[model samples]
Target: MKKYLPLIILLFAFIKTNAQYSGALPSYKLVSGNDWAKAKNYYLLTLLQQDAEAAKLLKADAGLAKLTADKIALLKSSLAECKDALCLPAKLKFTDDEINTVAERLAALCKPGSALDKLIKTHIIPSGTYFQFQTLAPAQLLEKAWRQDAAAINHTIAVYAEGAKPNYPQIDSISYNVKKRGYYTLMYDCSAEVNETVNARSLFFEPSLKGALTYLEVNERMQAGDYEPMATTVNKPAADKVKLTKWANYPYTHIVVPGAGPDDPNTPFSGEGMLRCKSAARAYFAGKAPFVVVSGGAVHPFKTKYNEAVEMKKYMIAKLHVPASVIIIEPHARHTTTNLRNDARIAFRYGISFSKPGLIVTDKYQNDFIMNMDKRCLQELGYLPYKLGKRLSDTELEFYPLVNSLQIDLDEPMDP
Candidate 1:
């Protein structure tokens, strides 16, 4: 049995890595700095703007120049025949040849000593603190990230091209226009087109480029900046406190409390949520870990103003008598998958030791579900955020942080 232990561990890892993540994910957000930004904005313009040398090379390159011109011409020609935003996506989406040309131009910039290589080293590489993209060559990493962004932009074109309807239509408090035709606004007025000249670069990233604009307009959360610069916003005092404490003495790095959103629309925090928070507070007092991370976002009951993590933190402090200095609030995870992933992300970014396992303290049902959460994580997050270790008890399980948790999932823009 002792000799077979190594083989058992290898088998578990093998099963996890091979989990299927098929089809294009619904959305994407590229990491600009510490925060994730809209993928469409980044790829279409921001990337070039940030790296002037690389931008100059791409803009000057004959391939991109010709591709841009051709795409602009195509869009200009189609504008007269196109009736509305719905008719423009087919004209604006990248063709295989155009994509290949763009890829080639970007590939040129990945060479050693090039401007893009420098940008990659300084910006892209450092964004993922855990060296998430170390396995991929610079070119491969750039191409993969760019392609995913393109796919996300294209997806928005298809889903929100006509215009997105509000996710919660039944709620009367939301305006009629918001309820009926979310993001009815457009970048260009298509009401009666006689054609003004479109910018070459903008033309190069059409339909979805337009769709990305509408998506942001509809979501209206492009700039909420909820708990951003989390290094300072939520983790500062706790991180500072942790610095003076001896981590080796604790059995766990942190006691993670994944938020259980309220079922009632008007309710800010649920009973189940309190149960989870109480469990974590108990673990903290017992010296299970040095910190308590309450993980969640504005999710349940759709468009509810209350944030689960924020509410939970209040509960723990006011009700449980938990010290504010020892609690970290992760207020941007919309789902159970992100709850775990975001918790791990907070742990990694806040100087928590990945070598030390974190204990997840939740209700028995959630704890049991977590034991089989690998499939769900893979399906939604494309990789397991943490490696599941031993189950400490009925309501507590141990998990080690994974570097791959840094890989941003753009599907949930509000939280990503």
Candidate 2:
């Protein structure tokens, strides 16, 4: 009981805060399949306390609880399972000519919007961010395992949807507005087995049924690259036309400079913010990058009328005598997470491929911390913020959209 105190308290707080809502799950067709998953999570969470009495109190359905016990043990072993299909197998010919051709071909095929890209993106590419999990499991054993996980996924999604139910005939769009407690539903561990061929389950989504099923088919296709007739290209939008010749102002890939908070009345330019801008300008002049992307909104201490990104760009122009044209200001990100997100949005808008990680320009400590932070920050922001439509760059040019994400929740749940 003591061990479960925090979760118990969190649940109660969640309930109390959301009491204004009807406290009823939405009546979507897929929501009906969520009960078992819900009960199993209750069982597993209670099971973790190691108190048989508390487990009994969860009152999770007998069947679900029993199944959950076995699944929980399996989860532990799954982590150490095979790491196959993660990368391409070794080459057949060591001769430079043959291997290089195959390598180049495979690399081209796996390009951002190639015919054979990573299978996970195929799932969400259909509906952008809104989706529900539907099982397309290959076998009975996997189906059973999936049921347990899906139930948990559905349970969390139901809570989130109920807490902030969208309007009827919900418009298809990405939303990260869900409450903090339901953050677990953001991504499902679709991998029923550790060695599951396609790991699309690791990607984040709204954690609903259709979304889950879309990725299931994607992962299933990963082991054997057989994309069932229309599995990967179902509802994805067409690629944005990119006039690459004139889009970029520079010849080489540039550095991303995410802005820190701005100063207030007493402090004209914050030490932290100035340091970030100065570092970015120094790198720009050092020939490390062709240009610099300075990103941030009017933030810090709130409502003071100082825009972080703009101020940084101004500082760079004044101190380094760097041409103003070399700096791009994204003036709407209020935090470090959005700094990356808005940068991606700006990149996509300008026909830039964010697939290549930029040299993040900031002080050493901030650089380390930003690099270490999980990419799930994208999930928390409710969209990829970069890749969505088909590849815009032409055949001669290669573009890879940023696709790395994690399973963590946000430090600040509300950003809008």
Candidate 3:
């Protein structure tokens, strides 16, 4: 009960923010989908925490260490004083010298025969192969990770701050809700008792991190072991089914249906969403593929209780009579980019062959949107999640999944 206390309170407290249109709080387990509790989705932080020698190197540099502490303190001060999201980033941005110094120290591990290099090769690189850290010199990788981590932290704070508009529609409401609670306002006073509870659950006060990084991690206590081993919970049957599947018999490995979330808060599934599922079900019945992969998260009209994939799977099974075994629910992707990326991850991990192309079944408008989204995918995800093959029809586009889609995205923390 003690360990569960934080989660219980957060579940009830944050749940209402959904009604008011704020986005869901970050869940680290869902973000990284691994047991990386300390670092969550930040690879550089994981490297340091796992290596005592590396942590010691940072701590031993009195100047850098002091600077780190000072920066953290400064962040706290700024949070107390900040009036808007725009000011937080300017206050927290890391200086070039600080980044270079830390990079130089950590890069020492990159020596060809060093233990750190070996760890990066055997552990880190495989953990996120899509990061393409292997292409970088050790120093370069360290610097890049450090800079990205710093920027990510700052970005989260800015998102949380009042008056900032996140690209994600509902997130702005979260910023508004937090401000209403007096979280970022100078005059809003919290009692010691309330402060203790806030430390356990608030984005600004997660127990595992201090200062701005706390904002980056979000709701750590509730997120602990949450949705971990996601493959086991969400897709274990599909994974098992894939083991016995005869891939050569099917023309395609899977039929993917990207979820269209309902815009109205009271609605469970959109008409477009139902149509998309119907389309995939039609393809499945046509013997187009052995499985239908539904991709989406609880993202629509700001933190609606409905999850797009979960609702779509229910519709498929109940209405369309699609077998439960053949419908794989990927209930994490928020955008169309992640819809493809996460489904590709499903394909790779669940024994679907990347060699065989998968067919995407969606409305003609969405199909056109997807085909022309190369620029958007590259801009947002830094790489394409799939290799486009051909246009089989207006409703179908042929695509081969890319392994790079497995890379964790820290930028989009909610669905990373």
Tens digit of per-residue lDDT, candidate 1, span 1-416: 99999999998755553231111111112444332345322432345455668677667767767776776666676656764445564565656666666677777767988777776655555455223444577776666666655655554444444344322233211222322322233423431131343466533444335445444444454432476656565768896786687888999999889888777889999999998888888899998898999988777776677889899999999999999999998887776787888887666656677777999999999889999999988887778998989998988999987766767554444544
CA deviation > 4 Å runs, candidate 2 = 1-252, 263-268, 375-379, 382-416
lDDT values, one for every candidate: 0.65, 0.39, 0.64
lDDT of 2 by residue, 372-393 (tens): 4446554454444333232212
1 or 2, which is superior by TM-score? Answer: 1
Q: Which pairs of residues collide in candidate 3? A: none
RMSD of each: 8.5, 23.6, 12.3
**Could you give the candidate ranking by lDDT, starting with the highest?**
1, 3, 2
Candidate structures ordered by TM-score, highest first: 1, 3, 2
Residue-level lDDT for 280 in candidate 1: 89
Cα error, candidate 3, residue 414 (Å): 1.4
- How many clashing residue pairs appear in each of the predictions shown? 0, 13, 0
Q: What tens digits encode model 3's per-residue C-alpha lDDT throughout 335-409?
A: 899899989877865658766899999999999999899999988888899988898888889999877775667
